[model samples]
Target: MAGARFITLFVILSSACKVNSQSSLLEQFVSADTTNRAARFAYLKKVSPTDTICLNDIKRAIRDSSGDSALFVFNVDGFSTMLRYENELAQICKSNQLKFKLDIGTDIGYVDQTTGCYQDYLDLILFEKYGKNFKPDLHKEANDLYLANHLLDTISSWDCDIRPRCLSANTHTSISIVVDLPIKAHRKEWVVDKKPMFAVYHPFMDLSVVIDKDGNTSGYQLVDFIPARRQNKKYKEQLLAIAIQEIKNKYYKWKPAEINGVLLNTTHVMRLEFEAAAISK
Candidate 1:
């Protein structure tokens, strides 16, 4: 009788353990949305008010998540307004040497065929004026853009080598920020756009993007953002130095991994530094 009771207890305990494991995985994969209201609310309470755009509201309705990282996924609407604010953010991350990934949507939103810029305001005009009968062709164009940019993997594959020996890894290490910018698509304006022109172009910033020991996506965090200038170049050097110092200090057991049976102890640090002029557009 005692043996039977022991077996029954073991079965119950195992079942509970399995449930707990599954719950944890769900939490990891789940997007930041209302379905996880309790967790989302708790997270917002912890964010600093100083973070340029207050993410408190969006936290409740996020469709994507960056694990425990407090990510802010801005769309074209927010991108327009955040232009002034984003530079500051880039500076902070650069100063702190924080490893982050910047994900940008490749194609989406209202695009101008002539200027290669998306006239995002057109959407508002169409909705207010023509309602559903508004330009279906334009709507289709925007839908196509969204579908093109929705693929997350493509954005994560950029080789942003602004600094020397930076971003030399194959694993996933990224931070994504989507912005809506007008692409100059007018035939007259087309002459001005350089190579690989788009009706609407999204800027992506990848900071400290590197692979992990387990052959998975992992990167170090650079502070937040730094100023955009010659001085920022020095800041990149300093940030990289600090990151290397920290890795040596903590995560002691973390050893460099071999890629293709070849060990690459490359002292490469991922960095993001760009001109305010380039990003402002």
Candidate 2:
């Protein structure tokens, strides 16, 4: 009798363990498909644009498919941006009780909206809040660098109005150009750790204008990268132009050979000599 009771208890515990293991397996990452229909539908209904039901239709596809379960729309807007605001979408994921890790590739959407806060914070911590007259030498270097790199061809500039507070379809419609962030440069490298240069911030190469069907720009995203080699080509040409202009303005009285070879006659050569002197110091 004792042995039989012990065997029964062992079976009961083993069955419970197996059930728990199965539950764990159920929660693993799933692809965008039917099994995760419920969660996907919830997110669409919550965030989809009101004017068009295309996003809703996409969600319905998952519902109709057999055993397809993915948490978020994998294609439209990359996953990283979604995850950054996951708190807003947490309800759908929690309701589904699905186990998943979001694999949204590098976020290049360039939709930063905290301009006021960012500017205020930077002013408070990084630099003294000075008006237009308070230009730093670093700003001059950055400006020169940009002009030297982007002077060739027609560099396009646009004043875009981005709506940060607006997320839903209704708000997307109401987007207005209140204020804009002043873009400082194209290719810039800020020192993160002093020893090895790490590129922390870089402006996007391609500009994607996200406007409504009405032609009013709601938001814009930057994509595609202009390669470094291409930028270098433009930079060399621009530098040459600036050098010629400066020489003509300041030292045109001297002959070409003297201007090219002598100090103070050519800004390009003078800058080179100055750099060499600094290095020798």
Candidate 3:
């Protein structure tokens, strides 16, 4: 009886020591990123397969340091918007480092992850589900879909790098932001609009655009309107209608978003700031 009791105590102590050692390694990893600026993620990658403890520690550290507090706690909250918190966290991570990985750690539990980015706006769509996953067609243009071999999955955290949404990742890094570089489609380029007053009146609007797979504006609704100056009632009615008609006329000029070359019939909200030169028909 005494021998059994001794062995039990020894096991407990061993587990405690193991946990502490892993925690110590995590502290070093986080510290090195800040103080030991030379500690590369490549080095950590080499040690991850054999050292799951260190990898798991680093993974959790990434969450604790970068994960959204609301998402971790309020996943089921009725009034909060925190779906796909892991993707948001992933976005933050890749914003800092171009090529990175998450979920290298073993754990009792981990945040469920998906390669799809479906915001609340998609709730009304007639979607088919494969258990927790929706049809890949719905998410063909998601932000997370741009990663290398990305998937519209329902599983653990990113096994690969997570970067900007809808933007191609090759050679696109932090340096691109500071140069005023133009991005490809899915992001809009503005025009000089409003022929009535080339300098005096300015207007801006946000349109909730539903672009079909054919890259045409299937439908749209004005979400926001800001007119530089208030016009009379008749003019007000005509003004917004003209703006609406102007956008609808460009049906063939738009680009649809996609993933892995698969077209996505998704909704996009666009903000437009118009200059005096472009609004006239």
Q: Judged by lDDT against the true structure, how good is candidate 1?
A: 0.30
Q: Mind giving the per-residue lDDT tens digits that candidate 1 earns over 1-281? A: 11221232233323322311322211221211112233323433444444322242233224233233333222222121112123333444344342222333222222211110112222222334545333343223333343233323212221111111212332233322222222111212243456553353222223443433333334455644443333344345554444444444432232333322322222233433232223432
Ranking by TM-score: 3, 1, 2
Residue 267 in model 2: lDDT: 13
Tens-place lDDT per residue, model 2, 219-278, is 223233332334333333333344334333433232111111111111111220000112
TM per candidate comes to 0.19, 0.15, 0.32
Q: Is candidate 1 or candidate 2 better by TM-score?
A: 1
Error of 1 at 241 (Å): 4.5
> Which digits, one per residue and each the tens of the lDDT, describe model 3 over residues 1-281?
11221232233323332311332222222221123112232243344354444455445444543433211111121221122333543454345342223222111222322101111111112121122222122222222434333333322111211111322222122111111112111222344564333233345566665655555654566777665444322243444555556556532344444433444455555554444322332
Alpha-carbon RMSD, each predicted model: 25.3, 28.6, 20.7
Backbone clashes in model 2, listed as residue pairs:
27-99, 33-68, 34-68, 35-68, 36-68, 36-69
lDDT accuracy of residue 27 in candidate 2: 18
Q: Using lDDT as the measure, which candidate wins?
A: 3
The CA-based lDDT of model 3 is what?
0.33
Angstrom error of the Cα, residue 279, model 3: value is: 15
